[model samples]
Target: MREADRTTRQRLADALRAEPATPSELAAQFDLTPNAVLGHVEHISRSLDRSDERFLVAPPTCRDCGFDDFDDLLNLPSRCPGCKSEAVTEPTFTIE
Candidate 1:
């Protein structure tokens, strides 16, 4: 099927199954904003809960101090709580 014909969530799921990717990567692949991709990913996570597959998250980290203690895995933080740095790495997701 043509990529344009597929739903955004379907495209996101397909990309993630093919390989683990950050939200930014998915956003680029789906031609969406990173925040938009996060919304789809959140729904994907819930959908996987009732299926045989599972959604895996590689939690975002603070590039400055290697902090990975963000309470919410679905939303990217603007700054690190540990070092107060804005250089935080986006979380990666995959299906397994």
Candidate 2:
């Protein structure tokens, strides 16, 4: 891996270890796109899988109906199936 990429991933892992945050929040803190933050988080999750540590995810919820049965925890849902609302919350990630 490139040194800068490695450093960024390390920093991302550290930040996640410190606190749970949504992808948008992590992107803003790291000056990266949300997609980029997701990529780093995915890698971090894999790395954590090999150890005693766990990569935790708080799945997104629908603000309108409180629906949160998303099959994919990594991506944000566009709308709520329960109420068809577009106001869906983004998933939060953390390392524990």
Which one wins on TM-score? 1
Query: Can you give the lDDT of residue 8 in candidate 1?
Result: 85
Global lDDT of model 2: 0.90
Worst 10 residues of 1 by lDDT: 22-31
The candidate that achieves the highest lDDT relative to the unseen native structure: 1
Q: What are the lDDT figures for the candidates, one per model? A: 0.93, 0.90
lDDT tens readout by residue for model 2, 1-96: 564666888989889899999999999998999989988888889988899999999999998888999888998678888899999999999888
TM-scores of the candidates in the order shown: 0.93, 0.89
lDDT of 1 by residue, 1-96 (tens): 998799889889998999999989988877899999999999999999999999999999998899998999998899999989999999999998
Q: lDDT, candidate 2, residue 77?
A: 78
RMSD of each: 1.3, 2.7
